[model samples]
Target: MKTYTVNELLKGEQLLQQVKVNGWIRTFRSNRFIALNDGSTLNNIQCVVDFEDTPEDTLKKLNTGAAVCIEGTLVESQGKGQKYEVQVERIEVLGTSDPETYPIQPKKHSLEFLREKAHLRVRTNTFSAVMRVRSALSFAIHQYFRDNGFYYVHTPVITGSDAEGAGEMFRVSTLDAKNPPLTEDGKVDFKEDFFGKETNLTVSGQLEAEAYAMALGKVYTFGPTFRAENSNTSRHLAEFWMIEPEVAFLDLMGNMDLAEDFIKSVIRYVLDHCREDLEFLEQRLLQEEKGKPQNERSEMSLIEKLHFVLDNNFKRVSYTEAIEILKRSKPNKKKKFQYIIEEWGADLQSEHERYLVEKHFNAPVILFDYPAKIKAFYMRMNEDGNTVRAMDILFPGIGEIVGGSQREERLDVLKERVAALGIPEEELWWYLDLRKFGTAVHSGFGLGFERLVLFVTGMTNIRDVIPFPRTPQNAEF
Candidate 1:
């Protein structure tokens, strides 16, 4: 007997051949047909049983979610929904799921209910399709970087430096929380901590990727990063994976070109390879949008949306220009935006970013040359003494999918900026040393992996894309 996955059997020849198949039952119909899936594909293979030959007790064990092995003859399916199926000659129940206890059944379940049972949510069609597309996108990332002569760099997850200056880091300590060591002023002494210095989970890998990029020429980091902010929004996650690529001898304009090419390549890869999964998700999205008003629904289908980005060039504009447009727009004059744009230096909010990309441009927009005071400390200072070579790529629905800048290459300028931001000069000595030694024109950008997933899979919540989401207070497996 030969073993076969549900997907393999479904694609096999029409001739009757003995095959052994193993999978979990999705649904049992009329006590004769079994819809089984092994996760190789979204489609399930039908297993028709001869009730006359199969024992009554054995038929009762073939409940939904039951694990079973079957020896069957693969032949053309007589069913209307499928082309090929298995005519079982023998069946063995490896595990049985009780109809009363199994959380997953043949019925429509809410996304909230599935989230509560995340451990078993992958067995569902929606979660499984999302995961498959996520995996494909991840592979596409590695392949894209590798094919483009970029090295995959692994940065440390824990560090003493704060890359983003947000100070929303999760402390990694082993000392006693109730009563720890104290200093002379009765303050909690961090000198006695595990690392001999205060350290937390890293917020970004861009700084470290820059260090490697100087030597390697081209480097990218794909790993988990953490933030400790207590945000319960659908888009905010305490822990998420990040993709950062830094290149040597590259300027701000080159950085934008690289980002556009990289994003389009990976998205196109998913479109070509994950067609079945995307098609399933597309239909699921159509069903979901039926509940919403016509104006709120997406105008383009999922496939059309992906192709639109690949075919069109992203609109580029300066931050100063964007500010002027926002100031004169109807939203600002009507006071519709929650954070109205009043001046040039005001930080752009999500609503503003969406309005720029969706309404003003109707395409992906790249806004560069942001105010230095509002951006990070490492960005290169422009000649105007006000703006930095910073850029943010805003998508139609997603506000900010990418953020990056041309790093400060001048040793004195970088030191001054770091000191002015109140960051410890000693903590980032190595980062500064890059400028001192042989730092050239280098630039990099960070893409939130989950947000990219949300864009491609048409998912609204960031929690739904990640397998085990680590949010404000929820860490359940």
Candidate 2:
């Protein structure tokens, strides 16, 4: 007999049609009713099996988490509560699961406990819903970029240099740890390693995407990225995904427009395609203390918030103006900030970013023209002597979702900035060569994929969204 997907069964119009469905039992109540989810959709089919129809011995052996195939007739329920249910004709146990051995039970399991059994957590209702949403969101991302004439670029995972320049890298090596290869000066010699030099997992694909964008005019990369920052906070992850888009002949405004449109499209797509899953989450999985409330928070949901941010023109202010607003704000009155916001130079922290987006603008805000001394050397220096033409997109819940700018196209100025930043000229010769050959104006942004997922799903912790999350001192499977 041909098998049907659970989602297909739900959408089918043929009631009382004989169908065969296979899945693990989610829950079985009173041996007469069983809820089975195939992982094809968030909605699980409730099968009504009489004790006489299912042999007493067979019924006794069946348990939650056991894989089973059911031959049933789909019927519109005359019962008041549920719309439809399956009337079981015959059942076959493909695999029996011992209730005591199964890690997931019908009882409430904490997120910490769930994380330990990450491999099996997807079988649960909450995780099944989350994974479906995650899959839908990923598809939406590719669709948005592909529809907009952006070429999908696959950048390398193993790289020779750090793209973020943040100095947090997980080294790739084959040398013995106890007695490693050493140079004449008693330093660890990376030349003896597999790559014949220092190599590490890529922190970002932005730099490589820029090269592709220069040639292809528009390109985006979606891939795994690593960071070795020893942070155990809810927001920090050692390994996570990043979506970066680079466009040639695009200025700062164009970059922002693309970012805004890309984000909004993904949100709209996921909301439309994963309505059932999202609704399930909004109703049961989410709560006020444990999860988000079902009631709509804003005039628009998170998906609509993206459209609102994109449809309405964004508020753009220079770093100087933002600092002035901060200085005048009430929080600045009580205690001295660790990074004071002054006129010419000061780094913006999470608090300052939140204040601008949440308090001052009451919407998504873009702050640009940061002091060159603080920003990356690749950012284009503004006409003003002090600041560079970099921009950061700050959202209400998350501080900075995107960081991008028009790149420094002039080789002479770029070289000067590189020198002033104390980076060796030889290390970046290939990057400078692009400027020497044929450099047109190019811009791009590095978006934290987890942050975007958090904002869209209303998930508070970044760790919950990702599977097998890696954090500081936590790499347990």
Candidate 3:
């Protein structure tokens, strides 16, 4: 007897061979047909059972979500929609599920309902396909970096530095919460806590990755990063993964090239390897779009959108140029935009970004040379003294998929920017030390992993792409 996965059995032929399979029952129909899935693929294996010979007790336990092992013979399926079927010779119930208690029934469920049942949602077709694509994208990310001479670095999850300087951080404390140590000024003192200083979950790993890039020339960090912003939207997540890559000698132009190439490589990999899953997600998106108004529907299908990105060159436009375009656009002119683009220095919103990608350019766009005041302190200041060499890669549906910049290498300039932002110099002494010692014109970008998955999977909500989404006031498994 041989053990084979449902994927292999479906794609290969071992006619009349005795095989063993372990899986959970997806559905049992007519007291003779069993649909078993083992998490190996999206398709399930139809196992034909001999109801007359099989014990009644065993048959009774073959309900949905019940784990089972079956000794069966591989044979061609008499039914349609699948290639192979298993003729069960012996059946053993590993774990039984009460049909009345199982929440994931064989019917369409809303995304909200499936989210509450996140633990069992993977058993469904949509979630399982999503997760498979997510896994493929993750693997492609690492493979792309590895093949491109980038060393993977694991950055700290807890740090004292506020990388984004937004200050929306979840504090890590070990002292008593009710009555903790207080400074003479009556503020809660963090000196007595672990690490002997204030620390929180990291918002971005770019700062740490910069240090490694300086030492190793090229390095990347792919790990979980936290943001404590109380945002309840389709795009925000309290805890999410980030992919940051830093190169010591790369400039802003080189950074844009790298980001574009990296994105295309990963998408290409997924398109080649995860075709089945992508097709399933594409059809899912098509069916979802049918309910929306004709004007609101997507102009391109999900797979067509993917190919469009791969086939076209990303249009590189300056932030100043984009501002003018948005200002002249009908939406901003008619006050239809939620936040109209009024001036050159005004920050561009997601609406504006989507306009550039989806409407104006009709291709991927990379906007650079943003106003220095709106960008982080690390971005390199251009000669104008008003703008920095920061760039954002905008996709059609997703606004800003990748954000990067050539870092400020001058110690005095960086220190001035840090002081202007009210960030204490002592807190970033180590970061300042990099510029003091051997700083170069390094550039890097941070890509929100969920947003990438959301784009690739054509999933509207960020929560659906990740396994256990951590959002504002919602952390249930």
Candidate 4:
């Protein structure tokens, strides 16, 4: 009379009570054996049904992907293959799936093919497990922040000022693009735009979150951020979610500690709650086809790496030190490095970041105090005058998963920095006003949510973690 989850059936117990289960047939071997999965868990329930007891017409109507409701008695499995199974008493066909029409079958389908059916791909083992892990990770993020006394803040999606000032934003306007409003000087008149000014999708919510954090003492924003870059790489996505946490009265070191703790908490939560889904991925998805054993390490490895890096007070080196290390290592000797790391002011590429974290440090490495010329204007300037107190957390597999810095709380410093960067000071009046009124020392970091999911799940491509991923040229359903 009551529905039993597939995970509940996994326990070895005989059921005296009647149970109803609804799921799609994963694999049906002959008339008596059917493997059904309800999206409740990674493991499917093998339902043993006798076709002779049921109608032959019903057996003929059943196919893979067809929805079915089974009233059955749960019993211990005597079969050698599986642990427990369900003995069907009454079978009801809720929906029939045509064998030829259903794209998903028992046979293997390529990842490219699955990408085409992004909506339907969740039914597959790999995507299903990924989605579950993604959900768990999101919950963990909120839980970690909430438990640590952080207020959740929602910032505006359409913003007038570019947070990153990287010129990568999708313009939102109702004005004609061919012959837009213009002033007598022939300059595009932003006053006539829909919002009476230029507005685009927010690239990051860190700046806005900082204002709230200064008031609330601690605040975080988890929302979708947009980037209009046209690079069609595995790592680049047109739209992605970002988790930005800002804390008042916090320095760069405190910011890094919060990031490390947040990452470890999410990793621990997923590994604890989604054990079945992760086990399925380890056994079926990430494993080699030849049955080569995948390296299985305890979940503690994630926390261990985080603690090891945090405990050592991450090797704080200026951009100059990084360059020196690169030079001494003889990066030119390695033919694999695309660009030679020579000068002090070179923007650290992904290759260089990976080299620092994976090779040099042999652990998670936090590279801080970047050259002010390369970093954003809001970053606090160091005593050295050239470098800013910006920090980037680099892991072994991914280069820069988290990026953050202490804000220039001083109004004079912020205004000077904005003027030097040639950014319009008029557009940033409200942001500057925050400093003018009552700005305390504050720091924050932005963690790319998709990248975090990829790192925890061991997913290689960014596209795999996000459902219906919006890449440069790809926006297929």
User: Per-model C-alpha lDDT, please?
Assistant: 0.93, 0.82, 0.93, 0.83
> Positional deviation of 141 in candidate 2, in angstroms?
1.3
In angstroms, how far off is 404's CA in candidate 3? 0.6
Better of 2 and 3 by TM-score: 3
Q: Write the per-residue lDDT of candidate 1 for residues 1-477, one digit (tens) a residue.
A: 778888788887644999999999999999899999998899999999999999999999999999999888999987699988999899999999999999999898998898899998999999999999999999999999999999999999989999999999998887899999999999888899999888899999989999999999999999999999999999999999999999999999999999999999999999999999999999999999899999789877788778878887999999999999999999999999999899879999999998988788888999999999999999999999899999999987779999999999999999999989999889999999999898799999999999999999988899999998999779988
Per-residue CA lDDT of candidate 4, range 229-318, in tens?
Answer: 998777888999999999999998888888877877787787779877777665553343334334332233333443444455344555
Q: Distance (Å) between predicted and true CA of 440, model 4?
A: 1.5
Clashing pairs in 2: 287-291
Q: Give the poorly placed runs of model 4, Cα more than 4 Å off.
A: 12-14, 176-189, 283-317
Question: What is the total number of backbone clashes in candidate 1?
Answer: 0
Worst 10 residues of 3 by lDDT: 7-16
Q: Order candidates by TM-score, high to low.
A: 3, 1, 2, 4
What lDDT tens digits, residue by residue, belong to model 3 across residues 1-477? 778888888875777788899999999999999999998898999999999999898999999999999998898888897788999999999999999999988899999999999999999999999999899999999999999999999999999999988999988879899999999999988889988998899999999999999999999999999999999999999999999999999999999999999999999999999999889999999999999999789999999999989999999999999999999999999998999888889988898999999999999999999999899999999999999999999998889999999999899999989999999999999999999898889999999999999999999999899999999889877
Q: All predictions: root-mean-square deviation over Cα?
A: 1.2, 2.8, 0.9, 3.3
- Worst lDDT window (10 residues) for model 1? 6-15
Off by over 4 Å in 3: none
